[model samples]
Target chain A: MGGPRRLLLISNSTLHGGGYLGHCQQHIQKFLGQNVKRVLFIPYALHDRDAYARTARAKFESLGYGLDSIHEFCDPVEAVRKSEAIFIGGGNTFRLLKALYDNSLIHEIRKRVLEDGIPYMGSSAGTNVATISINTTNDMPIVYPPSLKALGLVPFNINPHYLDPDIKRTHMGETREERIRQYHEEPNTPPVLGLREGTMLLVEGDKATLQGVTGARLFLRGKKPTEHEPGTDFSFLLNDSNASNL
Target chain B: MGGPRRLLLISNSTLHGGGYLGHCQQHIQKFLGQNVKRVLFIPYALHDRDAYARTARAKFESLGYGLDSIHEFCDPVEAVRKSEAIFIGGGNTFRLLKALYDNSLIHEIRKRVLEDGIPYMGSSAGTNVATISINTTNDMPIVYPPSLKALGLVPFNINPHYLDPDIKRTHMGETREERIRQYHEEPNTPPVLGLREGTMLLVEGDKATLQGVTGARLFLRGKKPTEHEPGTDFSFLLNDSNASNL
Candidate 1:
């Protein structure tokens, strides 16, 4: 848990206003600091990769930084190695993981973020791949990846855009909390962070805080879900102490 | 598509009015016909196997049929082979398939329904396992099975409790339609039947019909989603004529 890892894992890019990356620009800047000049953008999750990159380029340019899509470069590995910061946009988690595997960049990106201390930021399916596995993602299994294993960027898995159990809805499908509960029941599964819309986790050298306007729900295997408000530090999720008990 | 295959695939076990298997019982009875004496129930989908069987027992008893839980039998294969009808209740799809694999019943159950002309009925996760693959299910991947392949009782996949896209909601998650679209993008994927709640499909020999009050959304790869009314015969879905194009 103790490292010089800088990460801004956002739940969603858009809030209720439908602004593109409108709410998390400040947090992104705060995590990246002033040294990172350009950001490497991975838009492999969605089918509309070009449109996604254009939207992200506009937002990053507005924040006084340059952004380049990995697909634009002939040598994708060198492109990632040369970047100061990395940003991954949201779409289908399976596609994103498959693309990452297809490009053979899983280890390269992991080294850049965890070893070199490069700033890392992602939203939705992007945030999903940063965790131990994409088992907790809300997206469909659009494509079958080589494995469900993901880069070990974080100790716990993240359930992005997590909707709490709706008490009033007549839908027979299992709710988000119940789904995460089932996930926890699996052997050796980590705690799941249910990050709601407009919320994110900002990780610095040794600690991380749940930032933004909304609260998140946490699911530990056997215990009732505990709610954490914005600004709550979740550095414990990076440690394996509680996960062993489960 | 022609065979002596009798099946009733339901979207949900309960309806908005909170009736316990109320909406689909008539369809089930008609599919099973008047000669079935005992039915075998699969309760491996969720943790509440006992409670699920108890509820299903009361419902089936009222319809002049005897229901027994397969878990209670000493030999699960013998139970499935001897049963007059088969019912699978809904819960987690991954767990259900995992359980089926763990019990080594996939081939046994497939033989019972596909070759023996047994009456098969399932709801939600139950219906999901009847498709060629469980790739299009809305449930989370809580656990990984040996394979994503399902019972192959049907020619096409089914998405139970399919929710329509809400125009006014501000949620950023992928709508039901978009998820299915992504599924279709994968190679060799079959057409997906988006079965809305309170609706079901009745299969007799080579003919299959969408029955009940609500209609279903049909998604074929690279085409606009088409809606099918109740009583619409879905015989085409049982053949690979359109699947070869995908």
Candidate 2:
């Protein structure tokens, strides 16, 4: 299942003082490389597909690749099957997942990315769907999906745009760390990777490396959360057995 | 089915510079009155039921009421059937709703509160469950519940501890207002009330009043969100017909 998988799971598209994908432009260019001429964009996370596609197209074109949205195609499955690369942008996680199931593109997209060895990129909501489940997402349940289960491209779950708690503020809502701890309280749950904004996890073949400016925090069940800096190899997370004890 | 419905739905338990239930103590005592002696506590939203129960018991006791957690009882449904009043504190909405279904207390509690007229007090996650659904909650989906359909004690949904977006921050996450808008995009959804901290809605048989230090915002499907003051009459929301147009 892990064979030929290529993914660049980004925490967010826009960082502070930056435009869309401005923070990670160089990384996106390198991941797609010189061979891929065009990319298929999935903009179902948001309500306005036409506008979302236009934004994504403009961004991808500036990165030296042609981009077409799946919503524009008559057959989304066929579009996914023939796509050189797939990029799912950020928005509402539940809406994005519901659309994926509703469009029947889950299996098709998964097959193309995992088996066919296509380059895959995701930010925020997109990064959430690339993991085992959307249970760890920060988005509101604006809509209910058929299931929490996602693409399972990664063995673990992800919390994108993860924010550290401001101890100075007395807001009683559960902190991002506390929410991840709650997820671990459930039975047989996997480790949760909290990818801070401006950070990403790049996976190629069987290797996963943390990339970008900031670091990420990994939470294992019944253990203190550990922080990993940029350039740390997270390939151990790719193995299901390594996540068993976690 | 509105019958003898009585409820006090609070946004959050603790506010800045306040202890647990500190800001809304007077309203709690007034809502329960001199007739009710004991309050049944539901601590299911948290991982440590005993700890949650202890904190709640201390608060209720200080308000001159006896508090016993449902977990201490062998039959939770029977406990709800015989309780004088109910108080559900704040935590994770998903975990709390799952426990309500798991313990088979949904039907029993609804009967006691709506028909029997036992005063019902809910804060945060509790307020979320008292509404039509938990679709507007700020909590993560730590666990999957059987359904999003909650107690439906109120005709509208609630977004508790609702915070206004800070224009100063460049975080890409959806603002609280935007999340509720996305919820309306779904068909047949109810109106959403965004309750700021230190605020609550007090509902009697035929009347509902917004009472607290701050105010609330009401969002209709296609209309602009309107702000309401503390003393605004929200009893219109109790009527199903009023919500239909909203």
Candidate 3:
């Protein structure tokens, strides 16, 4: 189906002791490839669009690719239609999804990435919106979108910047694991991928692989979450029927 | 109106290394007083209603108050009407709010607490819904409610189990302070009270006092958050006009 949908979903933009997008530089560069000369950026998650654009532009340019934010374009849908690659940076997932819906870019971007086969890259909130829903996000509902339904670029949901429970901490707030389990308690939810900091899932065609230094956790509805190390094949999750069987 | 609407909004039910509700026993006992003999409990936040109700009923019984869960009754609205006091224990904010809407108890509970002057108590997720909206909750959006609009028993919003930023940690997820600031960036957001664990807000009529062992941080739009001690008065927040001026 259209030469396999290409996507690079990163967990966090900046890892500990690193600059913005510093940790995932090589992976992003390789994902873009030599043929792609430009990238379309979506910086709607944060309140300040101009500042977000500046940070992203500097990093993308350093890697030899010109970057233009979709916010700067009068016709954002048209801009997506002509982009070589699309990158949505991290921020609040609700705000990001709301902006995507408000701009009416959901279907246009979906078609561009899924049907036309353009490379799509997302970090944190950007990565979250690429999944079935943002129900598993670790963010406050500062703003309400029309719905929790996301772009559905992938078959499963994602919890970016997923942190393990600090057994020593006295705070009674539900752990990240407990929160995701609650999501699964609701009927008919898809699988959830808990992407730790400095980790990402790279999708090329029908194959998806866990990539980065840290490991990711795969959570199914009725089973205990299984740990997956870096370089693990997550391609089974790309197919709905295959994922359900797992 | 009705002898200064009474509410005991707690930050958490269990303090670190403490038994459930053990830390807040005295405050709860004082709030309920000798006048109220029974408490109607809402334990819809967690998946197991029976288990939640049992935990709550045991705790309330030890405090010399008879407790019955709303789920046990055929008429939840009538249950609210006849209840001497109400206690909503915490688990997940979204799930609690969704269940509240599903059972059509928002208006009923509001009338019982605000208009009838019955003492209403909440912990964590429960404290979140007592505020204007659950926009500042620390919990995940595991379930989507009909609206983020909560019971609005209080004028301001709350971030319960609020933790200060851990300077030593390398995690890139937004700190509680940063998340609340992002909420403030949205238009017309209420002032957020960062209720640290082992702390709570006791609302008596027009007066709200920061109680428990720890302090709280108050956040307002376009201003730095101010630290408030345990005995600090927050009556100004009860009046929307007064809160805006501050």
Q: What is the TM-score of chain A alone in each candidate?
A: 0.96, 0.98, 0.98
DockQ of the candidate models in sequence: 0.66, 0.75, 0.89
Off by over 4 Å in 3: A244-246, B244-246
Cα-based lDDT for every prediction: 0.87, 0.92, 0.92
lDDT of 2 by residue, A1-246 (tens): 234999999999999888999999999999999999999999999889999999889988998999999999999999998999999999999999999999998999889998989999999999999999999999899888989899999889999998988888666678999999888988888999999999999999899999998899999988899999999999999998888767
Q: For model 2, state the Cα shift of residue B113 in Å.
A: 1.5
The DockQ of predicted model 1 stands at 0.66
List RMSD in Å for every model shown: 2.3, 1.7, 1.3
TM-score of each: 0.95, 0.97, 0.98
A105: Cα error in model 2, Å: 2.0
Interface RMSD of each: 1.4, 1.3, 0.7
Best of the two (1, 3) by lDDT: 3
Q: What would the per-residue lDDT of candidate 3 be over residues B183-228, giving only the tens digit for each residue? A: 9898878799999999999998888899988999999988999999
Q: Candidate 3, B185: how far from true, in Å?
A: 0.9
Q: Candidate 3: deviation at residue A54, Å?
A: 0.4
